[model samples]
Target: MPTILDIFKDITKLQRCSGNHSEFIAYMQNLSQKLGYICLVDDVHNILCKKENSNAKIVFQSHYDIVCLKENCVPEIIEDEYSLSAKDSTLGADNGIGCSYMIALMYERFDGEFLFTSDEEIGLIGANGLNLPINANFMLNLDSEEEGEICIGCAGGVDIKAIFNNKKIVPNIDNLDLYEISISSLPGGHSGVDIDKNIPNAIKLLIQSIKGCDGKILDISGGERINSIPANAKAIIATKKQPKKLIDNMKIEKIDTKSEHLSIYDDTLLNYLYSFKNGVRELNKELNVVQDSINLALIKTNIDEIVIEFSARSMNNENLKNLKDSTKSDLEKIGCNVNTYGKYPAWNPDINSFTDTILNIYKNINSKASLRAIHAGLECAIFKEKFPNLKIASIGPTIKYPHSKKEIVYKDSINNVFEIVKIIAYNLK
Candidate 1:
């Protein structure tokens, strides 16, 4: 039997995300054969493995899908201890770490149900599909971020996609060209925690500058999901006439960002205007710690108007609010209409969780005790509603920068989280 870290590494090799996990699901079933545990797959591909005689039932939920594959997903052992690293692609640590953690428990003697669901990325389709028996009394969710903290509550989120009813923008032969205006290089991060970083929205700022330039608005594309901060966006504008004073005009004067010319802007003023709004630059003084953030989530445009979707989040709600408010106000001041939607409540943790029975076992093993809340979404709220009598606790080791290209789970955290689950499965009431 492979160790927890080894299992984690193996999982990284699977492509289990959204519409892409059927193969990985089969692989997980194959592993179950070694432990004499028959994996049951639901119509929706949710998998459950059960040990019948266990006194209490603790279900661990995780998704088998990854957001996407990096350019070259060559898995390599990092730090020599264990776990795999990939080039440019996401390591799928967001929930793959959770899957490996639960898999470890299912094989060995366990005191409860091991639940590994799918479709968590696109939506909570897998877990959302389950019809549980009344006997399922407890849940320990490992699909959380950070190392020591037990996730008690989570924000309920909805991913929004809006398309502008745009007519094709015909370029002006008099002076029409596909000019690319982009806000690049800002440290994009998880939409919830990093949203409050006061970082510039690339699509939003770009639209403002492009609009200010008053060249014919042609085609605009921006962000993808409401959950992610858009890092880079490109747009094309037609220029039958580029005024000289547009970028420096009174409208977008407050933006501290820059712009360039692909000969797309007829007005040199648009260049000077863009030169002012250098949007989305990294100001992280702590190197990789990511103390700052930006929301460049989406970009879209129509012949008449351009729309960019943006979300801002910070561990600090006050700061998050301030940044969001500022961005909205600034955009509107420049005549760009801004709207907000699909807002959810943030999940704050109770420092004193009664530790329940899980904490005692975690402590007995001398593992680090982590008590923190993160800026991500989970089913904690839904689970709490469905099983109000059940005591809920969530813990996972260092899965960082979820929902992005930089996603990775620390191999060491996988080991630590697996051990924690083992203790919970053994001692759950």
Candidate 2:
């Protein structure tokens, strides 16, 4: 079996974003056939590669799809460490890391099947479509970002999708030209856990920019998935002449932490959003590692409307409600109609769980372990619903900045994670 890093490096070379997963699917099949595994690829391109054994079943799941690219980026290994760097496009560590791990597991001289799923970034179509003989209930989800954390519960998420004008419209006056406005920076992250922190929402920012410029917003939209921080966004605007001046004068405010609320382009909302804020880290004084936060994911404008998307997260369910309410309140006050969605439930940790068993196994392997929940939506929610009696846990090597270009996996952490996983897979009765 090849190292997970090597497999990841090879697959990352193929740009398999969302619907464009044919190359990746074919690649996995080629490997399966070469290794003498029974590879079954369904009509929709979902792959199930098996190393035969006739006992209790164990399944490992991961996806091969990624978000669209911003640039033609090739994954580069940094200093031979487990980490990989991409110049312009996202590294796709979100699920690619897990996919690579699953591929390696098939060749790990194991007695199980590795299910390489497709279209998980958009939906759970790969796993959703498969009709396994109900032979396996032991599923190890290898998609978690952090190495130590073993997530048992995950928030359910729904995409809030809308359509505005598709074609660009030219302004009647010469001075009125179309201009694109965007919100970048403001650390994009997983939505459910990060929403409580007072972070900026790019989608909200685009709308505010429209209001601030005294331009009528023909339409608005933001965010791609309820689980991920929107990476790219755009807005088209008709300015009389000073597109430069209009854009330069635009200002954005930090979200408010105390009240868990924010609004775009409203000075009052700004005051409230930034209120009681020592920035995002200090949102909840009690938590040491920032249990909650918010981010403005994307800001874009079309010929008709300025669109913005935001992700809200919190450890406490009540805080999630407060933040949601505050955001709507602020938008309406700005004279903008309010609509919100991409609602995914937060995954709370189980204090008393088989977590201790995994933690001990990791420590015995001279590694680290963590027990925490995330702000993002996970397949755990979908699977747990399907198999209610299943005792589930999630773990993987440390991954940073998934769903963006900055995504990387710690090289050494993979061995540790793999060893721990081996112990769990073999030791599980």
Candidate 3:
């Protein structure tokens, strides 16, 4: 039998980035059949592997798709004395480790359900569109990042898109200086969990740099994904004068280009992005976490249109609605076409018999183990809604800097959590 790290290495070889996980899906299905488990894949590509004659009460769930910073990213695993990471790419350990644990349990012929979801990084696409039936009374989500903590609830989120027309004007080549300003190498992170970390957003930074010089936009694009805080952004502009007071952190380069038309876009585009309510809106003293927050995720310019995408999250549904409504109203007020989709509901905090069972088992191993909720969106929230009667709790190995290239997971934490998972699988009957 392969160790967890061995299995993880095998998983890293498959390119499983979001919107590009068909290969991994086929791998899981094939592996399930080889392991003598009944494999069922849904229309949305959520794979469920069931053991024969298993009476276990809990289902293990993990999303297989990962956030890839670059195109066709297959992480190169890097191992140190105590932890595992990737070589200049996202490790995918956030849920890959979770999936590895499930596979390990299957090798033991553990009696339970193993659900591998798809495209979770883009939005909970797999969980939201999940049509497969789950008979387990409890679900153990393996997506949480923290190790000594069990998550009982998570923030719901919606992706907001705003688009507006741009009028182009032929630029007077002699008077304006065409330059490309870019920002990169900043520590981008998961939008919801790291919103309050003061990590600079590359899109926001690039805008601020251009706005400082009052540059006329020619073309602009930034951000890697909707759920990730942008680590890199760049823009092209026509300025009457060199940007005098540019943001010091970004890279500025003078690009000599032939004459072209500059964008005569609405001032509201800059104002909306500059003044948009970003970061933490409220602090939940009760939960000691960010209650509401939004990320200025992505920006792109077409020949005649500009599109902006943002993600908003809150710990409860009402607050999420308010956040969505206010953002929509603000965008509509600016005469931009706006739409919201990929919205998932919040999972209210609860402590049920199943959670108590996991909690007690976790505490027995690590006395510091505690119950908490995160500000980030988790597929468990969708599963809780889809399977309301199923008691759910989430746990995972210690992962730092998820959704970014700097992601790392502690090896000891993986072993610790695996021990707990094995106990849950064995004792739950």
- Number of the top candidate by lDDT? 3
In order, candidate lDDTs are 0.56, 0.58, 0.87
After TM-score superposition, the amount by which residue 324's alpha carbon in candidate 2 deviates from its true location, in angstroms, is 8.2
Worst 10 residues of 3 by lDDT: 240-249
Q: lDDT tens string, model 2, 1-429?
A: 568777877887886777676788778778877776777778667777775543545677777787544433445434344456566556677788788777776676566667777776655566555554434657777888776777765544433222223333333443433455555544554454445543445455555565455443333345555456654344444544333322332333322222112112323332332332221322444333444455555444454444444455555667667766776666555444556664545455554445677767877765545566654566666555566655567888787766655666677877777777778778764
- What TM-score would you give candidate 3 relative to the actual structure? 0.96
TM-score per candidate, chains pooled: 0.71, 0.72, 0.96
**Which has the higher lDDT value, candidate number 2 or candidate number 3?**
3
- Indicate the residue-level lDDT of 272 in model 1: 29
**Highest-scoring model, TM-score:** 3
Q: Estimate the TM-score for candidate 1.
A: 0.71
Per-residue lDDT for 1-429 in model 1, tens only? 667766777777665656665777688678767675656788888777765454546677776766653332434434344545445445667777787777776666565666777766555666666664435667778777777766665544433233333243333445343344555544345675455455445555665657665654445565545556565555666543342322221122222222333223223323322443322323333222223233446656554544555544433345546656666666554545566654443344433333456666666664666454555566555566566666667888776666655665666666776777776666654
RMSD of each: 8.0, 7.9, 1.7
lDDT of 2: 0.58
**Residue 256 of model 2, lDDT score:** 25
lDDT of 3 by residue, 3-64 (tens): 99888889889989988768887888788788888888899889989876656678999999
Question: Which residue segments of model 1 deviate by more than 4 Å?
Answer: 52-55, 69-84, 132-134, 166-178, 182-187, 197-201, 208-216, 239-296, 300-354, 361-370
